[model samples]
Target: MPHASATARTNQMRALMGGAFLPSFLGLAATRVWLQVNLFASYTQSDDGLFTVVNNLAYGLVMVIGAAIALRKPFSKGNRTTVAWLGFAVMTFSTVLILAGKETGAVDILAVASVCAGIGGALGGGMWTAAYVRLGLRQSVLYGFLSLALGSLGGLALSFLPEALSYTVSMFMPAIALLCYQRAMKTDVGPQPAPEPIYDKEPRSTMLFIFGGLAVFGLALGISRGFPAGEPVPMDALQRVVHQMGVVVISLFIIWWFIVKRKRLSFSFLWRIEIMLVAAGMLILSVFPGHFTGLAIATVNIADTLMLGVLWITLQDVARHTTTDVYAVYGFAWASRVLSRDAGRVLIMVLGAMGASSYAVTAVIGIVVFALAASMALLLSDGILKLRPLFTEDVAAPARRSAAGAARETRRAEMEGAGASTPAPAAMPSAQAQPDPQEWFRDAFDLSERETEVALLIAQGRSKSYIAEALCLSENTVRTHAKNVYTKLDVHSKQELIDLLQNRE
Candidate 1:
């Protein structure tokens, strides 16, 4: 096992949170945000020999150390989620500290938060993301705000601002956001899958945030595109290639989540190939290299703006469906970022060592080929997807036949028991005789009238939030009870949950 990670740090953070005096999660959060900026500067400043080499070396050392510490925490205490957030926080803090000219103790502070707030932010983000999508955007508005506020404040304070302000932004803001999301998820479900299904509507707050965020990203990307770097054909080709690569990375991160992630989670095709078509169109424009007018570039930019929206919505929805941790998602995002970044660094070092522009072009070609491979993989999977039902049938037939046999066996035992030829042991019901989930919950588990009410709600397909509201309890408490109910009832997945709720036997 890797010895150097954020394990010891996370345990320390968890311990520090005792008796309501929550540890300064913001300070930790600040560290991570700053780390990104520093790591970026380190890898990106290829023009500055001294800065680039030193920064890259720093980047490598920190990541190795952080990972080492991250991997060594206690079972409950050694949580990856917390350590990541805290690590990011530390990264942010250290970056800000160094940038702000107060480099003292930046590494140590980061070492600690790399443990706690990291997990909270990572896990909590996922929980909140799901809550937002399912509960409605308006419902989770406060949660988003709190998170943004936390991030922004920590960012500012750790670098430009000061620690006092950073503490409030990082610790209090995020904690509030998490609590709000937890509350919303709890009361969103009803008592049972009432004969009528409970439907959810998106809140206006989410729409506002989504639009606002896109606008900001657009404005930033536009600014970064750089002014007429010259009409020289070479420069044009370079920009086209780089720009295309950037978008490809975005697709690599976002598109597969919609396509492959959905299928992995037993969801049907969630995104349209039309989306991939746009990428195809861009690739053609890039490879052909006819100088596109600024107007054409502007048009594509707008399309990309829209494309980004599509990506964001896809991500939000995926978060909703999969109940994935937002921070963990971010952490995964972190992994992509770090790997890409480090690869970029290693490549540059090798290129400089060998003296070649050929490596850069080779890298671009490799990216294009990988993108093509990804497309083919999607096509092949879609084909296999079509044959899934046939496979389902192959398994279902034999299972049904066996179920019939068991039913016959049980029927025979019942008749013999009724005749009283002898006092026989109670006949065990066949698998097919299993009751529907709700019925099973009501009878086999002997749940109370109220307990049964809650079980029925869950079985009927009500969400936790709706259940909490109907039961008039906080979401956390509701989850606790739900956990107990699930455990006592001997079920794990929600499908099983529903089957039991309905007494499907």
Candidate 2:
């Protein structure tokens, strides 16, 4: 029995290593490596490096297109696998063509290749994220962040190699991503298919947070990258690499200490810290003028890394909680991120072209952008707070409650068998009392009495907390009941629940 148990654990570990870790490593490594190699290509292709903007824009556009396609596809295993394989071919071919174009100075080929690669990345990334999400939020977030860290290190190493060698190596990443994706899909330990059908609506509050937070993150990263460099700091390439490595290390430590180890910090708290760090880095850069050097760059790098990790983590959390269509949810989120990033890049590129290249001008504009992003983040936080119940509902609390309820019932049975006296039966309630509007809905849908009570409150425009208070039930219980009500009635949102009841006549 012990050997069998150990064997099971070994299989689980292997699945995680192959499934979640490898694909993530390849995907992020490919992205960063592509950017780096393209930059090198740009140096030789054009004196002004304007083609970098085109490359980034191409990637962003394809990501958006792929997300739109994801929305149109039904969430099925077969479709996801097809998308992954197709993405693999496109990305691999594009990587090869772009490198070949760079070597031969074929500008048009590079541009076309960039667009095709972008499309492949979008399709592949969505499918990959879908597989990861099935592993649940914590595993997905952990592996995802680890992948980025490893990828960055790998990209940095590849940056030093000969251009041809670097490009050749990168061409293999999509194939690795495909393998990892397949492994993830074949895992036996992942989340089971949800029994309740997924029918989520884009709540205004949720959308506000997702779009706003991503915009803030993307814009900050874009401006930092595209804003014409100030007087070069007194640092060499090696020093810069070290700084980046250090920042990634520190960021990983912070995430581990707060989230994985201690597990005391809430998502809201961690998010606020991320914003503050980023804003602080920007402020330092602005105040110091050309003096913002190695430390400043490191600070910004750390903040950016944190923001990316947090954004993806939150996105996966949102997908996990809201629907079973993980691919669609993550794809939409990825599209928003890409669009926002490109928007910021375009703005900065235009400003640079228009002679706003001075350090002072860049700093001032950056500060303003950062301030606006901060405000949007605040609004997102408030929105999420107001909708906490909905956000927490889909994290599989129902299964936990079911197990707990069974335990409680078992304890009661044991007590009764041990001669514990039951309370005297209460007098029968009068049947002549006014009929509950709740009863009509309950009978129509075969709802439990508790569910019927929650449904009536929902129909009457009562919040989850209010229903909990009135019924003297815990909030988790209230949410569970409400979820059952929705599943049984085949409704998505509160409005739908009300509509079904009201239109019955």
Candidate 3:
């Protein structure tokens, strides 16, 4: 019976993880299929600049409006589910419209579907992003990476299927994801209210600056991603699949190594890498044009998708401070993302329409913009860190604390051997003897699971590098978390934090 019970418990754990991942998987799948089939492949034989631009613009506009409305309205599980369901239905219809348009060469049908899919995607993406955040940062980032990888694979698989069948399946996929999401929400705990709203008093200039910078970065990447309008190359479908698969495999290993294992780059460094990849990718596409363009484009797409995950994680960190509906903050961010991507697509289409000379001009412009975006990344990363630090406590926090505890015991033993007694730690007035300052600090500040670990290490006189090593995070991330801990405890530095915890004892 015990053996059976253990097996049952393991199964439940697996189910919980899978359920947590459903929304991101489906939301990403929806967009991936739409882009691959409608934008990339459909336009291979003809000038799809108009269709692509309209579709992206319509998509962006809907998100902006929907996000604004969601801000004013209160969030509830039922409301989010309802929106997901409606989106599933509408987007499914749009998929069908796209299929018909492809078969009959009707540009009008495709255009209308763009508007419909745009609205549907905004509803679904906004809700799903909020849900992803509720899962915590590590799980959310892992799931996003998996989602993009699987979604890309899924898009490739769909390309093999007949148009009608693939379209039908694509339509159903989002609905299935929403169903899973509804089920997950049933078992999920709701978020706690933040002590203060971060965005409520944010300056208008700050908002504009941040969103505008993101738009510029997005535009540069967007235009670079699109292929110049031309005759279809004799590239084999098998070769393209191989290129994409290779990218996916390489990306997975890189993500696991840097993020999951080493925690090498801070959020700031990661964005810099992303921008550099975009710049390099565009240059390769422009220089190499027809030959090996598939490989270059695949590389760019993978980097772009990875960056999207980073962007979301950053936004969640920022939004965590909001006292209002957290989804509203995410909604606004998503709107910015949509607007940036669409604006790039529109700009590229306009440039492509001019002449072949404009193609070189586009490449030159992309290279220039990429340089500018790279510079902006450094500046903006610092700003984002100040607003909400990305590096702090992570998945390994508990293990790090255990190691610290063990080290403390070893040191105490060494002291005893030297004939020195380790005195009892500081205690509060009017309080009984307390053991773990960690728990005391946690309860006093109402810190989250992650923050509590950080505070305990800080109180123990751990350095930023030490805390980062223990927590399996980059030093910059540790600093960010320390800043957040100080803010929450209403203290300014590690000494003050330690003092506060001792006082609360």
Per-prediction TM-score, please? 0.33, 0.66, 0.69
Candidate 3 residue 329 Cα shift, in angstroms, is 2.3
lDDT of each: 0.37, 0.58, 0.59
Question: How many Å off is the CA of 320 in candidate 3?
Answer: 2.4
The RMSD of every model to the true structure, in order and in angstroms, is 18.1, 13.3, 11.2
Cα distance off (Å), candidate 3, residue 341: 2.7
Angstrom error of the Cα, residue 410, model 1: value is 20
Candidates ranked by TM-score: 3, 2, 1
Q: Model 2, range 93-191, lDDT digits (tens) per residue?
A: 887887778789998887787677666656656666666566544455456667667666766677567768877887877777677667766765443
Evaluate residue 499 in candidate 3 and report its C-alpha lDDT on the 0 to 100 scale: 54
TM-score of 3: 0.69
Report the lDDT of model 3 for residue 297.
57
Candidate 1 lDDT, 1-505, residue by residue in tens: 2443365444333222211212222222233233323432211111122232344344434433443443343113224334434434443444344433424555554434333333333333333333444422211222232333343333333333343343434434334443443454454331111111101233435333333333333222222122122111122333333333443444343333422231121111312332243344345434544454332343333334234224333344333333234333223323332333334334444544555465554554354345334433432232222212100100113344346556656767866878845533454444335543434455567765456656665653456776675566788877877777788789997668754443444
Clashing pairs in 2: none
Q: Give the C-alpha miss distance for residue 83 in model 2, angstroms.
A: 1.7
lDDT of 3 by residue, 247-312 (tens): 466456645754445343366676666766766666676687767666555555555566656676
